[model samples]
Target: MIAVLFRWDIKAGSEQLFKEGWSEIVHLNIEKHGALGSRLFKSKDGEWISYSKWISEDHFYNARKSLDNTEQARIKMAQAIIRAYDPIVMIPVIDHLMATETTHINQLS
Candidate 1:
């Protein structure tokens, strides 16, 4: 799989708008394209981050070449909140990996 990392520093009072737009975009990418899915994160420095996964680089590129009207609209909505936007494409690599048993938040205490 290939991953796309998007970082945005949003303007004040635009959080909800950004989130709504992001959700729409993500849904479209996954359903229409071949995206595995995505996750959103917030940094202490006030950057909003999105990590999206695709089945392959071809899937990602093909989707970018053909965006529908709704997708374009969602992209515009996301652009409206931008102070800065940076996007990066990456491939994952690891030497050692292990799985941990599932644990719930309630079990932490």
Candidate 2:
């Protein structure tokens, strides 16, 4: 599996906009582009990070290309970003995906 790590610096007061747009984008990618899934994290230093898994490097690249149509959520995400770092792509050497449990959006707490 291919794992890609992404980081972004968000503009002040745009956090909620970014989160909503990002969640939408991720959902779309998973539904339409054959992405495995992804998780979003906020670092202590304020960098927004996303770790996404894909079937392969080619699949990952292809999926990103599909996002180029300038979808509204994508535009919203871009507007909220101060800067986005180049993605760090990796091939997993050892992976143990032991859990499949997930909470629904409304169940977030």
Candidates in order, TM-scores: namely 0.76, 0.86
Cα lDDT tens digits for candidate 2, 7-106: 9999999988898898887787787776888888889999999999887888788878885543889888999999999999998898887656565743
lDDT for each candidate structure: 0.75, 0.85
lDDT of 1 by residue, 1-109 (tens): 8889988888778776777777777778888989888777779998888888899999888877866546655665666565657579999785253443433631442
Can you tell me which runs of candidate 2 are displaced by over 4 Å?
Answer: 68-70, 100-109
RMSD of 1: 4.8
Global CA lDDT of candidate 1, please? 0.75
Identify the leading candidate in terms of lDDT.
Answer: 2
